[model samples]
Target: MTRLLNEEIIKKLVTMHDANRIIDQTFQGFGNKTVINPSKVSLDLGETGGYPFHEGFVNAMPAYIGDMDLAGIKWVSGIAGERREAGLPYISAMILLLDPRMGEFISVMEGTYISNLRTGAQTANSLKYLGFKDKVSIGMYGAGEQARFQLEAIADLYEITELRVWNHRRETAEIYANEMKQYVSGETIICNPEEGEKAAQAEILITVTNAQEPILLREWIKPGTVVFPMGSFQEVDDDLILSVDKIIVDHPDQALNRGALKKLHKEGRVTEENIFTTLGQLAIGAVEMPNFQEEIIMCIPIGTGAMDVSIAGHVYKRALEQGLGENYSFINYN
Candidate 1:
């Protein structure tokens, strides 16, 4: 029995990102079967001053890494509210990793950071499989932490010659571009509002904004563009989705519902059957990746508790081996 802290989780997560071996290994090793109890609503639990909203999710997810000979349960709570003046995130969570063999509480940590990284990595991994490794014209749609991580991961994979970034606000986009210019190899170009699509016609496109409606139109997407849409949950327009000939996702089951693809499916424009392949299936050689030509290939991510648990499982082992976090009891009584 042991406990891993947020500091430990964050530390190990960063190390894992650098360790492409671990990212690649975990990307290929883990699998989860999730059953989500549809979101339940409760009124007036707490004050979210200045006009706020709250949405909650409860899920029981069990997962395994057959090669690692490890399995765990990651039960999570998703409560996201509009940002209050309290200076906190809009979404927060908790994850408990329990050992299936002994039923011990392996770890407990704040899940917000983990959720962002793993979800971001899921897209990064997809890009590794489907994106152009040699090309470098990069365009990112959002300028959040997820956006930063996605760009970092992309730079790791491709020879980014230009990083064209756009957000709704000019000042914010400039700040993000300036911050990025310090680290990445290429120039960080910021686009004005009207020029978003004009800037999007790069070798690679990453849409990570909190966009409710599709910001990048279907007709505007250039050929051979690989769009890694990070935050589009409800869905995108029919034209944008149907216009793309190929689709790839992290988990078909998860993305097929709460992601852009499902919204496309519901519109009678596309279905689960339309999914060409998934990253995991392709990684495992379960599905074959076709010749990715000059087409707009899309990878829509649906966040999963399994992604959290698997990453936690990896961190628990590596951090312990390196003598990282404090030890605590994880006991279960029958």
Candidate 2:
């Protein structure tokens, strides 16, 4: 029997805490070199006639986590410049879970929520392991859906003293700050006129923007500040990349293939040697944290298929326990 789970059910079953826990365990497996996650395959659908209004791409990510005994693939799509005009999400995805022993199909589930949640969990984990301060003052560059999840997951784990937000559109930042105020115990300020001022004030700076070029600069970054840039595109200047005290990635290959470090990696500005360690190494105590001094640290997550499988596996188990989805026979024995 294959269970069919919808977004509503997935949203109901998975929480920020669950995502953080699952991702933490998965990274431990990664640190132990026990998980198998191949590079994602992407197909560019450039100016395709199907989507007359927007360009899109499709990606397939597959993985197997040995420790959890779960195998799965996430098929996802992203369409550009449709959110405002078309009222559609920029990304959508689905996850297919398989029985590890027999290779039998187990369940099909919505993946957008899982994707957002796991990405957020990854950011939270980076902050947990690599960040210097117990209490943080956050400055965010973008106020989109992913930013919301990042706030939720981080807020669940730490005490945020202040959240200062800056977006290209002031109204968008204002709206996000208003909606997100409930999540933070401290003040949520929408930065106006001086965006760099806010970035300088942050103990933990996060950028989730889609900008193609750098918006953050090395001079603006303060000592002992941890930066998390969640987008594939560049958000910070090259000087920041070259001068950061330490650089940590979720996966080195994936980070180089995409994310904020990709451009630098391609141009020979940064390499595998420049990276301090992967977050997985930090998670499992495989690497030692350097002595705390006034330093700048950057953590970039390109997002991994193993993370998807781990969270999806957790959702599957909970759904099965509660009997939340409809089960149908996919294979017939005559």
Best by TM-score: 2
- How much is 191 displaced in model 1, in angstroms? 0.7
Where does candidate 2 have its weakest 10-residue lDDT segment?
45-54
lDDT of 1 by residue, 1-334 (tens): 5666775445654543553344455656532222221222223323223333444344555555555555555554444553345566555656676666776677776666666667666666676666346756777887878777776665565566788888888888898988777546766778997787766767677777666677777777777777776664532456878788788766666666554765666666677787887666666666666666666788765655556666767777776777666677644544
Which digits, one per residue and each the tens of the lDDT, describe model 2 over residues 1-334? Answer: 8999999999889899999998988888889889988889877665244535457777899999998788999998887765436888888999999998988989999999999999999988877777445677899888999889999988888888899898888899989999999878888888873576665578888888877778789988878788887876788889988899988888888888777888888998889998889988998888978764488888887799999989999899999999999998977977
Error of 2 at 261 (Å): 1.3
lDDT for each candidate structure? 0.64, 0.85
Global lDDT of model 1: 0.64
Clashing pairs in 1: 224-294, 224-295
Count clashing residue pairs per candidate: 2, 0
Pairs that collide, model 2: none
